[model samples]
Target chain A: MKLMVSVKRVVDYNVRIQVKPDGSGVVTDGVKMSMNPFDEIAMEEALRIKEAGNAEEIIAVTIGEQKAQEQLRTALAMGADRAIHVEVDEDIQPLTAARVLKALADKEQPGMVLLGKQAIDDDQGQTGQMLAALWDRPQATFASKVDLDGQKAKVTREVDAGLETIEVDLPAVVTTDLRLNEPRYVKLPDIMKAKKKPIDTTSLADLGVEAAPGLKVTNTAPPPERQGGKKVESVDELVSELKNRGLI
Target chain B: MAKVLLIADHDGENLNPTTPKAVACAADFSPEALDVAVFVSGDNGVADQAAKLDGVSRVLRIDNPANEHCLAAMLAPQIVKMAADYTHVLVAGSTFGKDLMARVAALLGVLQVSDIMKVESDYVFQRPIYAGNAITTVEAPSDQVLCGTVRAASYQAAGEGNSASVEDISVDAELPDHTRFVSVETHKSDRPDLQTAPRVVSGGRGVGSGENFDIIYKLADKINAGVGASRAAVDAGYVPNDMQVGQTGKIIAPELYIAVGISGAIQHWAGIKDAGTIVAINKDEEAPIFEVADLGLVADLFDAVPELEQKLG
Candidate 1:
């Protein structure tokens, strides 16, 4: 069996977010960039599957500028055999990215597709499920646990209350959640070997997908800032305030 | 010139809060531009809520026993077929909404825009990226079968007290044959809806012990608020994972958010940034939580807890 994991290069999770002056987008100049948090989990899940002998090949894929290849190599440094680049500029629409992925996925025909539940940058969480639907396949979203058994696959999703396990047929899409597993740092030897790994490059146009404009934004602004609350001197005062407000 | 179809996600019978909230977002996007109709896969009661929400033109009631659970495998195909007749589709990012939205968009050969905070027009949506660090304005190209998932807590339901035209239809859907529901175990908790609650009180590693985690809960109960926790608190077993409010946990946009003993990690702040008011209580005034907090109290949680319990009691 084979596995395809999608990762994105985005603003580092640790950096503070700031909006641009023109407000078209956020400030990225001189800021840190790294692999998406969920994608890291997806890559780690693929690595775990490969280690379990369930996967023969693990190809890391990303859709963005050339810097995305570095993110892909991070996956390779961890354990993937090779990588693929659906090369495109930044600010690519989810549908367009999905179309490019569809083209690559059709050619690769991997038995499984793994992705982070949402990219740390976009947090859309739509690509994997969309891919599954576009290919006429089943999908398990926000998977906390995934286990493959024979022809059937079992997955536990992170629901509102707790884990909700569902079983689907093979050749399905699975998105990773927080509790899935922690990603490991690439060792020195693996990092050295990743430089020699081969990555196939493809274009969005080659995928036969035409970019048609759909949604447009009229305006953008930050959410309302929280107001200040005065502190009560004692719990008795708080309880009285609560009672006056009918909260108690 | 196609109409609209919304997969009414009422968790079987009752209309889930998201269903009405999605209607409000669709209303904001394009009122009367599309014929908004809701399709409930489970209970016909969802048909009952069609009247209460704004912007709904009709309700498609599919009372099928096979539509027992809102499983993605079972509901996606039906939504795909229903989507073919609609120009746009809207679903919330709630548990059932996210799954159905992805499946419906997939069946229609389109990808959905998830957790859209606001929609300005037919073609553009404003969504947060980089874990709420940045916002991106995206334009979806010519695909008319638009699929969107709205954040449940961000919008209000349409004003109640109106009835919608309900129509019952039998769709010879390519019924889902696979994907079995093993069994459901509904773990009950006393916590309010994390996303929609107006007031929230959260804890972190500073709370120190699992047994002591009740401080936040007690504080929340006093104010008719919900309880949340940082990823650290959840990871430390101080609280269940559901209470976690961070990048990967639950995202809450409450009216008032009080952080007790939380140092305010960026990941945790991402989930609560939309909170209307923020109060951070920590011994270390230099904690990151203080940067965004509207009020910072430089006091140990231990001193604050008993004081809170006593005053609020």
Candidate 2:
């Protein structure tokens, strides 16, 4: 069996994102970029699948600029056999990203496809499921545990209540949540070996998939600020303020 | 007139209270104006839920017990074929909405303009990214299936729409043949639904321990507010990560958000950015939570909480 993991290059989760002066998008201004944290977990899950002798091959694919190759390399350094880079201009939308992945997956046709439950950059949480729709396969999003028994696979997803289990045959999609697994760092030796690992790069045009211009993001702005309250010293003072605010 | 198919919420076998919410969005962008139809997938008893939504011209109740489809891929094709007579389709943006819209749109070779908070003259949508740090408004190109996910909290769930006996639409049983849902595990909480709770009392790193969360819970029950936690709080083991609200956690937009002992981090703030009125209690006046808070209380939460509890009593 083969394993497919989807990775993405995004702004580091720690940095405070600042919007451009023109209100177009976040200004990367001197900020470092890295693999999306959720994708790291997905890649970790794939590597685990490979380690358990369940997968004969591990492949990682990414949709972003050329810098994303570094992310694919990170996956290779960790434990992937090869990488595929879908080179695109800046500002790729969620649907476009899905189209690109679908086109690539159609050619690869791996038995199991895994990706992060949602990318922190967009948080759209649509691409994996959308790709499954295009591929006409079963999709289990926000998976916590994935069990494969021959051709049939059982996926446990994290929900508000607890966990929901679904069964899907092979050649299906399962997206990983935060609790799925802890991603490992590449050792210096593996990083050196990753430099020699083969990486395949392609474009949306190469896949012969014409992406319909859907969901054009106009502008992005931060939400309103949350204001704070007063420090009442005693119960009497608290009541007085509550009464004044008509919150009683 | 071209029909617009709307997926209404089905409560049990009936439509969900949010079905009208879906129809309102559908009617807004319906090509035929008011020529909208709704479909509820359940037993025959589910038809009344579809009939209750306002402005629904027709309703379709599909009952096929053997037609077991769980994932969006399975259900999308069903909705797509049902929507063949219609040019537009709308559903409230919930977990299922995200899946259904993405799948339905992909099957039709179109991508949905998703996470729409408000719908105006055109099918304008506002979606957040990088968590709530950024919001983007988008317009989708014209397609046979115009799809959008309406935020469950953004609209008033209207009721008392036109009553109708929906015709049973016969869908080929072969549509959703691929997927199987073996079982579901739900996170049972004694508290209110986190998203819909009007008054949400959240804790942060200041609380110190998971046992300290009981205080927040006590206050939540005292005021009937939902219990939420910052990623900092959840990460510190003060609460479950599921209760976290931020760029990495759930997005909460409530009427009154009472933040206690939380030294506001941007990640935590991003989650609660939509709260209408925010009241933060922290000893540090310099805490960022005060920057956006409606009321800033700089004091020891341990002392303040007991005082407030005493006053309420």
Candidate 3:
């Protein structure tokens, strides 16, 4: 069985994002970029599943500009057997991205599809579920634990109430949450090997997928700043302050 | 006028408090009709509770044995079948909504507008991106059914007064067997829910171990506040993931937020940025949590928390 993982290029989690002054969008020029943290977790899980002898090949795919290949190469360095880069210069919303992944799923016919629960950039955690709906397959999202058996996978999802365990048949979609697995760092030898691995470049048209009409961003702005107050001297003073404000 | 269908979030027995918050957001647009769909396994009382929410025009009960687990795959097909009568579909941006709504939207051939914080108009809204660091205003085409998840932190729960009519509705959709419910492990707490609680007290890595969290809980019990933990604390196994408060965890907006021993990472700040009267108790004076704190106390949490709890009494 083959595992297909979807990785996305997003702003580094450590970087402080700033909205463009003109209210158009965020400033992404000259900023550090990295594979979405959750996607890294997904890739790590896929690699572990293969290492456990539950699966064989791992293919990492991304949809973005040419620079997105940097992320795909990072995935290759991490242990994906190969990579696919779908070149889309414009911003691809979740619906269009899911459509592209569905097309690839049809062509690759992987036994399982893996993705980050949500991209930290767009913050829209819709792609994986949308792909499952489009592909007419089961989806186990926000998965923290995955136990793969013959023709079946039991997934432990991190939900608001607590952990929920669900069983889905193979050829399904599983989205990774934060507690899934810690991603391994890329080694120098792996980086060199990844450069030699093939990356199949294609376009949305080549995949028979078109960008769907979607929500249009009208304005962008920074969140309202919170003001800091003076430090209190003691717990007594804090209690008194709370009392004075009717907060206690 | 826009016709809206709000999906109620519930366990098999009771309605989630966040469902009313979504109703509050959907009511903001003043839709011609605001109907709630309660998908449950049996004749659960959730639909009756949804009917009491102010501004709800009606409650549609979808009873099926397959809905016992609230699997998105099963609910999506049923929701799509009933979505033909409404112009917009909304749900609370809880884990349930985040897991379910996209599938419903995709089945309806539309893009979901996630985390709608402000409804600018029927078709326009504002949402946070980059983990609430930036807010973007977006517009959906009026031609298609608008699907969105209301950010629970951004709206209050609608009041319980009006009793809307309840209607039993059946959806003719094929439920898939590929997905099966196994079992769930939920932390049953008697304390106020973290999401809708008026006052919240959260601990961080500085809280030490799970046993050490007793002080945090004691302090919270004194104030009758809900308890939460930072991602670091949850990741360290000091608390359950459901109690996590951060960008990836539960976003909360309480009247008062007390952070004990929390250094306050950006992701954690995203959850509480909307909170009122923020207070931080960390020995690390340079902790980022103090920057946003309305009141800062540079002291050890172990000592300060106990003293504060005693004095509050």
Candidate 4:
């Protein structure tokens, strides 16, 4: 079985994002970029599945500018067999990204396509489900645990109320949540080996997928800030204040 | 004329509060007609409950065995089948909404406006990106039907007053057997649900252990508040992940939020930033949680929680 894991290059999780002054967008110039944290978990799950002899040949794919190949290299170092970079210099929305992935899925015909539930950059958790819908396949999203059996995958999903277990047939789309698994650290030796791994680059035009029309960002702004109140003297004072405010 | 179709989120027995909040968002734009689609396995009263929400015009219930569990695979096609009569489709931004709406959008060949924090116009919205670090105003194309997931925490629930009529509508779409619901494991807690609770009391790593969370629960019970935990506490195995409140967890907007021993991370702040009044109790005076807290108390949680509980009693 083959596993295709999708990753994205985004502003580092630790960086405090700032909107551009002119309302163009968030400041990304010279910002630290890394593979989305959840995608790392997805890649880690794929590697574990292969290590358990449940699958073979993990293909790491990304849709971004040339710099995104850096994340694909990181995926290669983390145990992906090869990489596919859909070279698009423009910012791709979820719909366009799903179209690109669907094109690749048609070419690869992998048994399962894995992705992060949402990108830390956009925080729009849509691409995986969109891909499943376009491809007319099953989707198991927000998965914390994924077990692959013969032509079936039983997934434990993280939901609002609690955990929900579902069974989906093969050739499905699975999105990873935070508690799925902690990603493995890329070793120095593996990094050097990844340098020699082959990456197949393609463009949206070549794949017969035009960038889909989507939402237009009109402006960007900082969220409203909360003003801090004075500290209370003690727990007694806190209770008194709560009562005074009719909050208790 | 925008005919809006809002999807109702429920537990097969009761309508989730998120549904009414989504209704409020839909009502904000003042669409020509706001109809709700309730998909259930049988004669669940969810449809009737949805009919009572103020501003709801009609309740369209789709009864099917495949809808016993909200599987996105089965629900998306049915929604798309009924898409022709509506100009917009809306759902709550819970796990269920985020999981299901995108598939519906894809099937309709349109892009989705996720987590709509503000509805500026019929076709424009403002949503948080970079995990609430920035907000972006976006304009969806008006030529096609719009799909959106409402941030329930950002709006008030639609009050129950008008008794809209309910209609049983069957969708002629093929339901797939590829996805099957197995089981769900929910915490059997009588405490108010964290998402809809008027008050929430959350603990952090400083709470020490899972056993120590009992005090946090006791304090919450005093005020009839819901119990939550920081990602740190959840990661430390002090509580279940479902109790987690952070960027990756439940975003709630209660009347009041009490943070105990939580040195707030940016991600955690994203979840509670919409809260009305925030109170922080931490031993470290410089904890970041205090920066946003309306009231701060620097004290050991072990000592302060017990003292506060006694005082409230």
Highest DockQ among the candidates is held by which one? 4
Error of 2 at A98 (Å): 3.1
For model 4 chain A, where is the 10-residue window of minimal lDDT?
A221-230
> Is model 3 an incorrect, acceptable, medium or high docking prediction?
high
Tens-digit per-residue lDDT, B3-75, candidate 2: 5776654434544444566666665554463333333335545566666556677666565554343356556
Question: What is the per-residue lDDT of model 3 for residues A46-110, given as tens digits with 9 covering 90 to 100?
Answer: 99999999889999999999999999999999999999999999998899999999999999999
* Candidate 3 pairs with clashing backbones: none
Poorest stretch of ten by lDDT in candidate 1 chain B: B31-40
Of the two candidates 2 and 3, the one with more favorable lDDT, higher being better, is 3
What is candidate 4's CAPRI-style docking category based on DockQ?
high
DockQ of predictions, in order shown: 0.44, 0.62, 0.88, 0.88
TM-score for each predicted model, relative to the true structure:
0.90, 0.90, 0.99, 0.99
TM-score of predicted chain B versus true chain B for each candidate? 0.93, 0.85, 0.97, 0.98
Candidate 1 TM-score on chain B: 0.93
User: Mind giving the per-residue lDDT tens digits that candidate 2 earns over A1-248?
Assistant: 88889998888998888877677778886789888888899889888887887888888999878788989989999889999998887667666777787777778878888988778877777788778887878888888788888887888877644576888887888888877887998899999999999999888888886655756667777665433445445546655765677665
- Candidate 1: where is the Cα deviation over 4 Å? A205-248, B1-4, B33-44, B136-143, B176-178
Sorted into a CAPRI-style docking class, model 1 comes out as acceptable
Candidate 2: DockQ? 0.62
